[model samples]
Target: MSSTLAEQRAEWRERIAGIGDTLRAESETNEDLRQLSPATEAALRSVNAFNLCSPEELGGVNAHPRLQTQVIADITSHDSSAGWCALIGAHESAWLASRLPDSSVERIFAHSDERWPVTCGSIAPEGEAEQVEGGWMVTGRWGWASGIHHSDFILSMSRITGQEPEPGKPPPLLCAAAPKADVVVEDTWHTLGMRGTGSTHYRYENVFVPDEMCLAGFERPPLRGGGWLARPTVTFLTAAGYGFPLGVAKRAVEEITRQATEHTRTGQRASISEQQHFQGDLGRCVALVEAMEGYGHHLFEELLAAPINSLEDAVRMDDRARAALRWAHQTAEDVVRTAHEHAGGPAVYSDNVLARLLRDIQTVSQHVIQTQSAYIRRGQHQLGIPVRPGL
Candidate 1:
């Protein structure tokens, strides 16, 4: 299975290369439109480009966590907005694995195919649910629904029925899934960067979501899905989410490097590359970005190797995972900012590739998962203190 997974990953990488051949020319237009262009979307869909991190049972290519990360970065190197959507969508797949019952999997697969097989998920638990016969009636408004435009299903976090907690207390939360047809999408993704991701607000009211669609625990009965699905979903989601910032940072460095010899001071004859100071900064920035990737993979590899026999063990692993991602995100921000400065005036031009990269990285830095709050949470975790929810 691993071998097959590897072969499929190689094929996907090749496909990414093919798709990238066209993105540079269209990325600006797509970002301006606030959604993927029809031609770009159709071209990507033709090559099964959006099926990263899918379960094999659902016709997924079974890219492992590391491979999935690489895939998002590769795509982001061409188009940050598309990469952002893929990052969210791919991690959402990991978030859903082993959570859905076989019936739900069958249901999703019944209408899905290689061309389109995954749903987009909201990161926060911001909805309400009412107890009903054999299930709950879920209703709530959620924001940051990235990839909604292309998905067939949507996953949301909601307070289960009759389980509302007191003020300043936590409520009973369940991750629920519903078909996209039952979701109401709003255009709310306007931002400084990643304009094409279409991560807008959405509403679902009184939708009957069966227990099968609710992920009550980390495989309480252990959904028959194996491999990474059997691992903790939250930790995996945290780890995978870093891929977005990493990709944007990498693209910034690449764009700057290409223009290094072309940029010069107003009165200077030597290009930026010819200036020792700029060269030194570029070298350090590249090293930092590359080192962060190595660091993330090391921590993630260690996480996958760790065993989980108790909730405490799972929390410890998650803390480590979140910390590792934090390092990557914070470092990615620095790398991109350095590259932005090194690239000069062109970097700030609205239509320049460096400008887009800067915005995308900045946007990713503000994500709930990648924020500095994670540092505090990790510190608390290390001191054996209970951190906030979602850790």
Candidate 2:
């Protein structure tokens, strides 16, 4: 009578596979536009690909992490821009689903089959909220707010200037949502890669959000749906953030393999795939990608299983996932670079898949969650050095 979860996932996978051909065809256009085309966005919505881990009550499929990761990575194999958007859109949906209030979540999923009412958020408080009767008037500029162009609603974190909540704690930071009309999006996302994400700077000038739309920073206790979002923020973010890099590396290897099979150097007597050097490099790159991806997923399983009730447990969880992500991110870069080198001169062209992967991998690698500097923090904590707060 009803499709099994496995069947639905299989269908979704097939849809993803189908979209790859189209996305590959439009990769350059997406790059040129600095955002996914409206048609492409609609295509993504048709599959409900954006809300992979949303609560079932909220009308999302609540896709298992394994399938979700695979879908994101697989899409990346055909087109980095499309894959990048998919990763970000789904990642944002899941992350927001975990953090938003129940009332907000209900409204977000008011329509079961549609992709609208999604919200994007930021790291630190960027807005300054002045107290008002119903809620507060927030004003500030937040940069690199990804998913803005596609979002119907946006939540900006803001500091409440007039409150001294607790003795040791600084002024409370309030994360609240407002309609898209409240924002003045500045075109600031011109970039070498992931340009299709529409990560622009949005400004809020005294935008008022009701108290219900506001999520209290510290006192909040997973107020929204809890069962499906059992894992802590660290578990979701570190894992999702690294997905793009993993996809990039995978795509690079695939492109290199295809190239090696089809072409050879000017003076070479054999196709690149027939050459020993290309064989060694391809094998090495594939192994590197697999090892990092495997180990990352393993740690992800441990991360989900780890208790996050206490501060100590939370730190451990963050550290474990962070360590895995750091290694994977660095390894992905190395693997992509190797593949690029193996592709040689052909990798330099704008239309070349290897060239795009090279750019996309490097861009996603620079993300704060996957940055190499995380290693320093991890090493400091391990060696008994007093690392900064929130390490």
- Highest TM-score scorer: 2
Error of 2 at 250 (Å): 1.3
The sequence of per-residue lDDT tens digits that candidate 1 reaches over residues 5-45 is: 56856876787888886766779778878877766676556
**How much lDDT does candidate 1 score?**
0.73
Q: How high is each candidate's TM-score? A: 0.90, 0.91
Candidate 1 residue spans exceeding 4 A from truth: 1-10, 47-49, 164-170, 216-222, 384-389
Give per-residue lDDT, candidate 1, residue 15.
78
lDDT of each: 0.73, 0.71
lDDT of 2 by residue, 252-326 (tens): 887888888887778888988998987988888889888867876676666656665776566556666677777
The reply for model 2, stretches above 4 Å from the true place, is: 1-11, 95-98, 164-167, 216-220, 384-391
Poorest 10 consecutive residues by lDDT, candidate 1 = 216-225
lDDT, residue 293, candidate 1: 79
